[model samples]
Target: MVFDERLVMAFILENAIKYGGKARSKSVLGKILSVKPEYRNAIKDLIEYIKSKIEYVNSLSQDELLKLYEEYKDYVKTPTKAEKKSPLPPLPNAEIGKVVTRFAPNPDFVLHLGSLRPLIISYEYAKIYEGRFIVRFEDTDPRTKKPKLEYYKLILDDIRWLGIEPDEVYYQSDRLELYYNVARELIGRGYAYVCLCPSEEFSKLSKSGVACPHRGQSPSENMELFDKMLSGEFKEGEAVLRIKTDLSHPNPSVRDWPALRIIDTKRYPHPRVGVKYRVWPLYNFSCAIDDYYMGVTHVFRGVEHKVNEEKQRYIYKYLDWKEPTYIHHGRLAIPGGILSKSKILKGIREGLYKSVDDPKLATVPALRRRGFRPEALKNIILRVGISPSNAVIDFSLLASENRKIVDRLANRYFGVRNPFKVYFKRVSHIDLIKIRKHPDYPERGVRRFEFRDEYISLYIDFEDYSNIISRDPFRLIGIGNFILEEADKQVKIRYIDNDVKKAKKEGYKFIHWVPVDHSIKCIFIYPDTTYEGYSELNILDEKVDSVIQFERIGYFRIEDLGRNNINVVFAHD
Candidate 1:
């Protein structure tokens, strides 16, 4: 069958969304995975091929592209060239070089769940190599950069809280002149050309391989045009300095891509450089220059950057800098996950979620709130170690791993919801009873749950209610005995240990409950949930965040302190 990228991508995405989260049939998914076991590999190959094709087209002059139409067409089929063993020209004498790596999140926003795997694995590799880790900001785009204001400081704080701090901090805005000098060198070496391409027009040129009027300009003339561009000679995007390279070499990024453009954008004023600088380097150019200038020895970024890795070598060649050791991990795309940052951002903006860290979203904060520890995330991501075989992980794997870890250390609590009073006959005259908070470990912490005979509450799994009838022994959880009561409005019985064991052996349904008789006054949230057995259970809510626990009831958090009420209960789901 012919490979159609859009069709395949759409199909994969559709199935991912449909079957994600137990939302679809497993049998259907089994058939699908069987049919396309290597779908992700297929798409990844296509992305690299496209990246190379564009670089090939961009390396030529406008007229050069016209000469290479046939080559461009052939290049599109496949761009996998042999891995050339070209040594880094800058450090030819240094063999077996030691190198440092980094994960440079700017901390402007909370990390999207999409970013988790990269951040984790990079840190893991850095630890393994015992290399210095740096956290740098590509904060040159002031328009989108967050200022270090009170409200904006959460990003940095969150990164630290997650235990991934960098060994060093740096910012691109701190190194503008280095980039400008390198661009100047490219211009002088006939390795870059000045083109006054508009951003709107160039987005097409990005793939079309069609150069504009100034592509044929001589280096002398290009140098003047380029220098003028740096001095704010033209409006933003009205002119750009395009790197001169082989447009037909089968790599689109190497094709005369723009390295610098006028910097007057509609974002905030540059925090350091300000409006004084009228030209800014594009991502590729800036990265090349920074990697070289900062003495970076090893470069690691998402595998989405494989094309960048190849084309970036052009800069190293142009500037006479050594190419850093290259490693590209795959971007994390979890199965059954909403794996897009833009989607999460849209959700936050559209009120589908409260914020980037809304518990409903699978952001780090949500995970923290759900009783999943940051260490669990680290453990899951670093499992296979590092390799080029970077695959999108299944979310179920991470979730399952998290549950295993959390289930071990987290204290257990009992909570009941949609509660009705289970009458404890005459024994009810006794208004108070103290339930040992954690039956398994008493010394871990000292907290007693207070319960009254008149108002004891327990969560009878709506399923359990359907499975049983009246006079079930009280299930004291670990203490023993099942509650002998109807799944009706409510049922009550003595907290007996032996009968509970008997019910368990006979396959009797036992449920969860918070002893309502407690004086601590724990508020059961979602106080309005439907009570038809345990039919409308909310499990997703309970799987996010780390801090909240609801004993046997489930995980919970305190949203707001009620006036005079010391204990507030909110559902994790």
Candidate 2:
């Protein structure tokens, strides 16, 4: 470690300029130009770089973030590795405990439904306790790896959008040498052995707890064998680092697990490092090493990761590090369907759902775009509460929860779909298209309607009016006045669109409707079909999903049809 007084003086000098005599305030700047022993002054320019951009930093926009990468690389790098300038705060117990946690996500694809929950829980736990939560990309699978890194931007943006933004970021690919060093250390200590067990015999070995030929080797012999494995002297699957443990024990940790595998380094160069090495640590090993190096104190995740935790604890024990607190929660599963990312991505690739934001799935952002508020989702999850059992919840429960949040919120509108047109020759000259926007809540206000007697028509849904056999007068919607007029043997009925101030005067039945002419090109319909609802206890579709409502229509958001086609999934009524 070389000592450099000029560097420390420079850092303090820079901090003094930024924070007056409290040079301690600019911790990030102080660290950058620190003239400390073993600290390099090469990074001193980082402070000047930061100082030069007081105006430009404020000017930074998300759109120009990528472009600034080349110019502001240090601001980015500093956060990951402590650009913190403030001196340590006084400890509560004469000992300040630092707790670190990482939200490790595999970079195989963009985030999906199943991935967010664990990350959300982990992030909150870390944040609430005033601990560090780092975002680390588990990018070991070379075939699925990508260089665009744009997905990372989306991941961070979505996290921010969800209000669970990560504090720092790390890439697992950046630490291959650390993993290799640790792997070699394990081999030297006889804790890990190079197991050259053939593929045909592995299933027999794991299931039956039987030892293969390599199980009896000495530590020296194992080290030589490991060296061969790392040198690419063995085929991809021919050799692996098997942690020597009690294969016969009931716990899976006692079962020998592969720590490293020879991979095709050429094809899967580290996105940042590029083909620097060939042999690589598997997820379990890399994860364990990462947790130890980063001093992670807690790991809250789905019970699905419980199996990994079984063996992972042993690695922590071997390294003499404190095992992170593990809290396994049952996954949030919706019945009648699975939340498999592969299956969902497969469906998207095959054009099954149109895009990841398909209406059917309760995808976080999709739920948002479809009008599910952020706190609405959190409220839904909280109301569902904690359950230990493998539970299967109906989507209806979530829809109901969401509905409660948006109630009395947006202006109501009438949407007439599966259209059946109606006209009355009697009302063409009537100047008043009388209406109240909301019948129940008069204070919500109203919009005037237009009626051209001969041309006036109402949009009636196919399902409700398909059988127009009602015995009573169906109120004319939107116009607020009506007479049932007539009903066929089927449930369907035909009548004049009405204008009304009270239910008894206008007619007993209420339906939704839209005026023929509106300023918008879109057919902005409200809940014309709320009158005929599903047999279910709650009329949720009229309340949730793809529709966005402008008026107090039981169904608010009526999707518009392009010129060639109009299609809607049936309202589960």
Candidate 3:
């Protein structure tokens, strides 16, 4: 049986482009040689053939490689259609149009990948049911975890970038009066009481299931005490309002959970409202009150809040209000990623991180700076769904998803890292090399390059030079085939032919090159380091923010660092 080399080359190229120019030999062998019964007998020959052509296969530019894929993707294994991310399973007892969801974030810091899980989940659930989505800020604490006014707007912008515009927005700082009224109602109904016990005494009583003496006060007395507590009469830590849950409950923390406390605003004034009020509601009290009044039919929160959910149930029970449907998904974390706000803040303060957008962090600003698309984030969240299983995400998964989105549009350019000079010895006329701006998008027009003459010296990477075997012919990408005469401190090549088919037939390796005279200095910022390289001068004309593939290297976002030095942020390979 005669084997069609075209079909085999196409399969090799497809796998190469998918895996960033380097397709494993075992992977390609298993797909073609092992899978098909008729081809199994030729496995040994196929292995040798692959060994000879692997270097040439890996060096094909994105456009040239994908062009082969488009022609022969149907032969080996049909490329699977991308799976559509289904909507989340319906909320229990949730009515179609009546379902309401909320993403309440503390505005102390910028949103990170961990925070985006709830945002995407809640926003998508609301979108699925055609219901209202609420964006609320829980910023009542003026002391520790104090809200920064700047992050409030930054959070909104991040939400917008994620393709969500909240139907209703609320800030806890602006709803203090409402929270105070709700606390008064709880006191008036005797479902809550003023606790005047010292911190140590309350801790012992709560642990021993013994109520404090103040827990037995009459509703009238409690209301007066609360009134005094709300006024400037009570000093900080002198009094606190506690919801009256079963004191005998197994979880001691659930016994009489603190609802409201007096803060010494004179010492820690709020960023927004300043010292306008002294009484501040803790998380559960204010959140429970708002969920009831704001008509939040469903609440999506991290599973770590299961205890808080237990405490908030009492508030709903006391008010005789229906508690919002609670969906507690497991926390999403990136292993080895900086997700803690305190650590990130500390790093910033210590100058370890230039800003929140430092490429090392997983914060929203950092991801954006690192060229992560919002679509990639949305796809990841939707794929994970609301499963209770804790997800420790791998950054490579995100990079792969991002590559799928960017590969379709990112233009290909010639760039060489650790460049070395290569001079072609044969004389010939100048050649006009027309390269596509985007491989798949030909209508984008071709990027023209003028090769002065056949006796041209071009800049190629030392890595590529080291890989080439001396005396063997290889194709110089879009230019022509050449034999490496010398490969030492300086590479010397003699022109062979301009036929790509002859090079492929001979299993000659292919490499990328840039005209030495038409190249620019480039700085590529990676997640952990930066690379300085030389790229074809055509890259200089690309607009800032343009995401382009650096030939066989990776995709990078162009940034105008000014002064003729092009800076790019590496997205992925």
Candidate 4:
């Protein structure tokens, strides 16, 4: 028996739309076999065919899935109880109303795609439990990971764009006194000490599992030095507050880790508060304190921070405070995009990148400007979830998701690149050509072009013309079939009957064209190259940032609308 590929695709689309845009092969195969038992005998051959169909269906956007589902829903089988499940797992030990989560971002650089996992995970868990979500700026290290003033707002804006509005916002810089108070209490409790030893010397002692000289100081003596350090008696790198941990621990960095450090704020003044304080708390120190005080119950961070978690746990243990539930997921990597903040900053400084929002980078702002929907990004993150194994974001998958969304909404337009003029003989002296704005939704209306000459002249993409030049007859989309008559300096054709069905029946190639006299200048800007072209004059009505499909080409987002030409960015096919 021949297996119906459409039936497999229907199940895939149904499963994808039902379960966050991803379809499981096993589930699709199970459904197929359940409906058609005979197909089970030929499973070996059908598996690869179903796999390919699933791949194609899973690549569609939510809108595309819905549309495709309409066409094939009759073939889809009802989902079984085992197949019905939530996309995201419930947060461990989370209570509906009492749960709280925080996404702590350092304002040193604007948020990027790498930042989305924690941000989205934290926000999602908060929503799942109907709890409050907090956005904390871990800007305590003003000297090294210096927080820029502009980045705080930009980060907030990016988060908002991703549909995450924090219930409360906190800045670690403003809570310096709180952190200092905690440090003093820890020092008094003999859980921490003020170390005047140089970093190089301290590192050697920590690595060798030997105690620093300052580790033996009395609580009173340590307090005195801590006061002096805060009063500007200690220069940068001269003194630091160390948490007392197991010196003989396996991880040398976790042995007596530095909690607070004195910075020469006068030289490297903070952007927020210039030289107001001489000492600042380190990441583990401030984060541990804030998590407990700010009611953060769950901490979502990258697996790379596993050691930091161990170091921070010391503070929680010493202070007798309950630690928040830590969920460490693997890091997210974009193969071709730069995700390193330091590298991106260096690139910007060297003028390799225009800004954080440069199209070449994978920063959130950059992706946003490049016409990638925030929903698509969220969908990708949710699909990857809290898996400990690192995930690589495939550009094709992202483009497929974006295409699904923009395909239904974006109006179709005719854009001819490196246009070649073609004249059609035996055409009416005057005629009005009407084309639907959207092929799927005809109610959206149509764009009209008035032809005024006996010979209708139109411009088509040179590449399209080249491919169809040898064909005796080709169909002009939205117009009638035409036969090539001449191919001199000026190309010519003779118009035939307007039988689109005949063209389709014969499998004739169709090419889009714009009226020679009533077309708008267009420039399609890609990452590495540009395509100068002419689009239908109706495109002039499209606003900047509007995504539209150039029929026979891919989707494009209008970037700039100039008096002379419209600049659009090629999104995807």
Candidate 5:
């Protein structure tokens, strides 16, 4: 078959530019044969021509490579879109400018993968309609689910990292007077009553669908009791203002559910308000009041809160307010990841985890530190959408998604773990090796290494050394082919010709190596294990939090750059 030289050169240049200015002869040959199977009969002759083209392409400078690529890139098949579709379905009853959404977190702990679903859905929906997105901190329960001062900022940072900026931010602790006035209005209207009954008696009476004696108090008397309770007369558990629901309600917890309860601020002082207030609101009351006041037109939460939705609606009914649109999605579970706040806290206390951002946990901070991209996470959430069915997210799915994003962006470098030093003997003079920083992006430039001695030393992974020890000649990646001469504590090899076609024809296995004198110390951390290794010295040019591929290793994000070593967390293969 007569091949188009221009098209073949385009393929060669594109491949070479993608892989550090060095294209493989076999890859170009395969591309030609695939498009024109008639060339298969003359594969031997085609490969020789392909090798000649590759040699010319590799010799070109970065600028020349790019200039030729522009002329011939059209010959290379450009990727075509399958279809244009939105990641999330349109929200029901979502008007263009009238829609509003909220993500109300308790601020008792950092957000996990489960909590991220509602947050992303709400924020994206608000963006879709050009409406307001509110971030309300439901932090009223200072005794049980106490809000820490640090977590408020941490949660906001997490949201910002996810590319969401709230139109309005609210903290329930700062609006105690508003909740007090609402509670007083409910009591005066006889929609709620202050109950001073003991817990055991209330439980027995409410369980049997019977009202306690205190439930029958007059509105005036109940109002006075509530005022006294707020003034610290009622100690914790001695007084709880209950929303008057049906006595025969099927869900017993919904019957006269406690709305506002007295807590002794002297014992469990709130991190925000300290001992300034004695009365605190419950989840249902604070959420209901804020949602109405903040003008939240829609509520996006998990299906587990269906019962809470039912309970909060009574407040809207009593106050004669419009109910917001409620969209409760399914629970999101990461099969092996620890998403439970209590368990994570326990692990932290027991020293099993370093902190909330421990690489092992599935918390947003942990995921960020472990090299997961925010865009990958946002895409995952959008694909799940508002499905009501319980969803389980396998971590492998996330890894797969992340790989696609980092592959083209992350620059490649050599890293060796369990390194076994190998010396190249019989080198007569100094040699300079130039490898492209990225095969696909030549503009990023190249990484150069200067070998200044007759005997050059490099570190190869011990595992790779064991695998290739029996082979007569193996390719040292961008360097050249080498024949193993001695396999002992001090391993050695003799250099062969740097002929690309010869290496390919002889079926040489390529392996990554780092110069022993020109590399930096690296601590490679994974979820379950950690390895000490050496990476190319140019890795120092990368900033912390930058993700880069370790050639034959995997992608990793720079976590910390120490005085002598750099720390990186493994993202994916």
Candidate 6:
């Protein structure tokens, strides 16, 4: 079997550039196997051949390699060129400039990628129709899923980071009285009754399609019981205000669901309004009341909540109030993300996570800390565009979108991870060398490095040292090409030529290098872990949160800045 040597070389060089100018043998061999699976027997020979050619390939100039990689990558991937720009599907029964949407978060934790779907879609639809968008905190349950006081502002910050400003913000904690009045109205209208049956008996009766004995109580009698329950005459779980529904309804869950329940506020007080009220409204009740009272025209949410919408409709019909236009899109599953608030809180307590900004989690702060752009996130959400089909997105797709946005703006510099010192002997003595801040944008200016001493010294990537042995002549990146005299613990080289084109003619690869004394400490943080390394000194000048490319390494965002050391989060290659 024969292969096009040029195509093979292109694949090797492209993968090498992707991995900080040091292409691994396994990676190159795997590419071959993927394309030519029948070449299973030739794996050993193919790896040897690839290793043999890497020396020459490794010597190619950074600019020349990237150009080749880009060309070859385009041929292999053939990426789509057009972007979706149409407005979101129009909300049903929504009048122009009159549609209102709300993002009601529980406020127990920061918003996850799943949560962002509704937040972005609702806000976008509201904008598309020039309607009002509201951000409501549904922190009604002060017991099981307690609200974090700090998350209130953090969630707003996350929303603002996505370039959205809610027209109004409301907390359900403040609307306890409003919910009480609504529950009273339901009782007065003979549509609700206070049930004191044991939970086990109630479950049995509900399943048997039998009405509770309390269901026959008069409206006035039920109203007094509800008032007594609210007035602290009832202990927690002793009585609950149940919205009366047909017991024979096909859906058993919709059969007489509980509305307002007595909660011991003294044990678990609301974060914002503590211990003042003992009666608390459940999700269906509080959410329904707020949606109707706040005039929400559209309720955009995941299909998982379709049942909740069904239950809420009962309340709406009984009160003669119109339910919001409920748009239930299919679930959005983001693989490899910690979306559960309980799990995240547990992880935080166990010290498995540092904070909400921990890169391992998919919290808004984590994405932001990991250098994910708001525009990229918003664009991905927009492209998905309220599709009813269950949408499963890979985290890599988000990274790909982010790379596109940051590529144009990120300035370039050299970063050597796992550094191996290479001392060039018989080299030309130069005072200073200037490297382009960005290869494509010369107008961005240059990062100047001055050698106070006479001789040039640099640290090259440890993996690229094999190139020095396999390729007879190689270029020292911004420096010059040299011939190896002695290759051992430390490389001994003699200057052969200073002309890069001359070396390029010989198929030499240029490796990224940094002066031993001129580099600064850099901590490169990955999604899963951290790597301590060195980068160009000028990177210290980058402000925190500014994105930059570490030349052959990849794009990274400056997460923290200090006079002596800087921390960067890896964005993408």
Best candidate, lDDT: 5
**Model 6 poorest 10 in a row by lDDT:** 75-84
Each model's lDDT? 0.54, 0.55, 0.82, 0.84, 0.86, 0.82
* Per-residue lDDT of candidate 4, residues 303-376 (tens digit): 78989999999999998999998777778898788999989999989988888988778899888777888888
Cα displacement (Å) at residue 31, model 4: 23
- Report how far off residue 312 is in candidate 6 (Å): 0.8
lDDT of 2 by residue, 258-307 (tens): 88887776866666567766677777889888888887776656666777
Top-down lDDT ranking: 5, 4, 3, 6, 2, 1
Best by TM-score: 5
Alpha-carbon deviation at 238 in model 2, angstroms? 2.3
lDDT by residue (257-360, candidate 1, tens digit) is 77777766444456566666767777788887777766666665676786776677788887678887665445566654565666777877887766655555
What does candidate 3's lDDT look like per residue over 40-69, in tens digits? 556688788877667787777878777767
Error of 3 at 179 (Å): 0.4
Q: Could you give me the TM-score of model 2 versus the true structure?
A: 0.66
Candidate 4 root-mean-square deviation in Å:
13.1
> What residue runs in model 4 are displaced by over 4 Å at the alpha carbon?
1-86
lDDT of 5 at 290: 90
Worst 10 residues of 1 by lDDT: 83-92
Candidate 6 per-residue C-alpha lDDT over 1-573 given as tens digits, one digit per residue, 9 for 90 to 100 = 344465567678877887888777788887765544434556677777888878776877888788777656532331112111333543445555788999999988888888888999898878777789999999988998889899998999999999999999999999998998988888888999999998889999999999999999999999899989989999998998899998888888889999988889899988898999889889999999999999999988886787898899899899889878776666676798878888888999999998888888888899888788999999888777665557887888998999989888888888887787767643345556788887889998888888766555677887777777764788877777776777677676677767988887878877888788888888888877887778878776677899998877888889888877788987777
Model 4 TM-score relative to the real fold = 0.83
**lDDT score at residue 302, model 3, on the 0-100 scale:** 81
**RMSD of candidates 1 onward, in order:** 13.1, 16.4, 17.9, 13.1, 19.6, 18.6
How are the candidates ranked when ordered by TM-score, highest leading?
5, 4, 6, 3, 1, 2
Deviation of model 1 at 275, angstroms: 3.6
Global local distance difference test of model 3: 0.82
